[model samples]
Target: MLGFFFALPNALPADTRAKMPGMFQRTINLGLDLQGGAHMLLEVDLTSVLEQALENEKETIRQEFREADRLRTETIRVDSENDAVIVRLRDAADSDRAFALLRDLSKPVDPTSISQDKTTRVEKLSEKDFRVTITEANIADIQKRTIAQSMNVLRRRIDPQGTTEMTIAPEGDDRILLQIPGAKNVDDIKSVINKTANLSFNMVRKESNNEAAMELARRPGSLSKVPPGAAFYPEEQGGGLIVERRTKITGECLKTSSEGLHPEGNYPIVNFTFNIRCARLFGDLTQKNIGQRFAVVLDGVIITAPRINGAITGGSGFIEGSFTLESARELSLLLNAGALPAKLVIVEERTVGPGLGQDSINAGKIASMIGLAGVGLFMWLSYGLRFGTIANIALTTNIILIAGALSLMGSTLTLPGIAGIILTIGMAVDANVLIFERIREEAHLGRPPVNAIETGYRRSLAPILDANITTLIAAVTLYFVGSGPVRGFAVTLAIGIVMSVFTAVVVARLITATWLRRKRPKTLPI
Candidate 1:
């Protein structure tokens, strides 16, 4: 009864549902495949991820060598082509020590999982030259981690407002599948997800000993091949700045950001606060570097580079670029959402219109009706009216229960999900058929009507339970191994199976029991 009441809203028009009470207003969300929406397949740049991982590995080697033996390295550079790190020792005699440090940095590919697959394979090329090759297993692990992280970041970036049912899930080894149900603005959707918004505060090189930065800046190249101690940040407006390679503040440290007007210029700005730990570190960085400049970098582009006039002990600061009101709010939103680990390149894009979606919905309805009617008619013909009526009642209740559960759980319903429901309608009668067959056998054996009915339900209970349990296991496995609409189908099927068990075994039994006590028939219907 409660299920029927909750499922009522779905039968009404949009205007009628709006007028209902808050609790009754809920409805199952239509997924991207069932509604007009944009579908985008994005591929993660594994090259950038590998380069970043190798750079991090190089730094780890440098730190371990310094702390373990105080051994100085002449050069430690990432070989992107080979996905390896080569380290040159200042003293040839420290080769063994350097090798040991690199070896210590090596660990299992997955510390929590397998112990056999190593992350790094360390080898000494010469007396003073050593190369640490990142194993393929390690790269594969990194790809998984990067993809997972990017999915999380993309989820936040894509739907901060929570306006629609959006699907953001990993597609393959290096791809993300994004589906925005009922999304109209395809360009806007693309723009938001494409923005990496990786923010970092890099200290500007005012006076540096390394002429590599000067030489690199004069060359005017990308940030990847800058000097060892400096990073080249190109401004969004024009030109570029050479800043310290080491980042003092990053987007990860940001606690929150809000749109605000600048104090002097009255222009829109993004006011940001660092987390507790980064706040202290940021304050110290600002205090010690007074009168120096730092570039506010976003996605390898300089947003602003302001000079530190005095000690900023407060953890809060504002970014003032040529931002309008909307852009400021967007920047703040992006900062709060965090950064994507690797760039997402669009591999494919598609859009489905509402006309096609309505056609799908109509077709699904037709198929479901045909299936339900055929099954109910067959049951009515095979068994007597009394037995078939009870079975049909249970089947109807099963569907109501599915709808109510879907509505309450807020699960998105896709075309595949509708198929699951139709499949479930067919399965709902399995218990009844078993019970009817058992009752017929008992009646043929000369048992009384009430005795045969009781014996039928009792003897058929084991088979019914076994069948449902195995089907439930299959549904669970499908859910675990699948994503997107596939999972939707699994969820709908699983829910339907549960409801089918309830209606068939419980609801149908209760109705039979009521009839038995009232009519007290001398013979069984089956």
Candidate 2:
């Protein structure tokens, strides 16, 4: 009954099969080698993470001095070459106070640990100059955390439903491995994974004009002439818009976002709702800066610059740009997934065509059938009709149980996994061969048929267990140390070993017992 339940999913269509109860719905998933999919190796830009950290530290220092009257500094700048922040104090007398404040802000190693692994080290460069270097420990910790966060964001963006058989895991220190089985659109997946999706709202510079912005945007040489505290960003449609460097709202403030069509123009747009605090803050900003334009920035490019006609208190707004339905939906999906901590570069990409996968599956199926038939024929010929038939029944049962077990566990079957199944056919019959030989010896020794049968099973049990256990250990080790197809092979090999033991010892023994009771043979077939 359990075997029937497990095997049902393979016979029904996916939609109809899913309607069944959970216990009966599980089916063996095919691996990428057997099912077409996209394979990608992404490397996280760790240098960007460190640079962003430095910029954040610089901003924090600026904000700290602005908030604290006692800690005053002339200038705070990030020195990329030195990988540190340089702070110039207005007065040398305030250096000690500034250093103390910065030290207090440094991250502690742990609450319970006595070791002091400060995030920053403040060194006195001169009377008024101080150099703050980020610690190696902090960089390592940030890199680790950022990679983990990026992987999670990538997973959410690539497999929102989580039903697709996808694997996203850390490959190395700064690389991630992604495998999606049966993926049709590889480019779309790549685009979704690569997008940083950093969204922000910055007000337009009051003194900046479209003429100056356009000139700066068109001619790279005119960049130096652009006004201070303002930068030009390419507009979505065309031209450019100059906006302030400081952002008033960021993507983190967004509570929800969805794709929708504009009410007036009927063009696709991404509608967003902000959290209560950001909503109130946005309302006040719009109310105070009426008639002024604010730029909606996505990943540093200005998507739109809409003027505030009146105060907006609803906390809801939509971004307007030249967007198709698909692009708008993708944009909303990214916003919902949240932004990645660092940029991801595609180090490697591979796509397996469905036709090729089908070919491999067919080849594996043919090899498996050939192996099974050869093994079955050998067992039937070596042992005469009744005993050979018994061994064949156990062998057939072994295959069914292996399939049922794989289905029950939801294990992926790769090409190599099919090879494991074929190998199991021989191993299953090998145990029966040992038992049959032992029975023949007992019969030659003048033992009764029933006694010979019982002794044959009892004497062969230890050796069979010893051989399968050793192989099982090897399969487990392979699973732990290997990846991809190697792991798939390990899964099937281990399961086959287990099922073979059951069918050989228990199933075959029961069949022999039933035959003995029904026929009451005077002499053994051997």
**What is the C-alpha local distance difference test score of each model?**
0.87, 0.86
lDDT of 1 by residue, 486-509 (tens): 899999999999999889888999
**lDDT, candidate 2, residue 139?**
86
lDDT of 2: 0.86
Root-mean-square deviation of Cα positions for candidate 1 versus the true structure, in angstroms: 2.9
Candidate 1 residue-wise lDDT at 252: 95
Question: Total backbone clashes of model 2?
Answer: 0
For all predicted structures, in order, the TM-scores are 0.91, 0.80
Single out the weakest 10-residue window by summed lDDT for candidate 1. 207-216
* Number of the predicted model whose lDDT against the real structure is largest: 1
* Candidate 2 structure quality by residue, lDDT tens digits, 69-95: 876788788899999999999999887
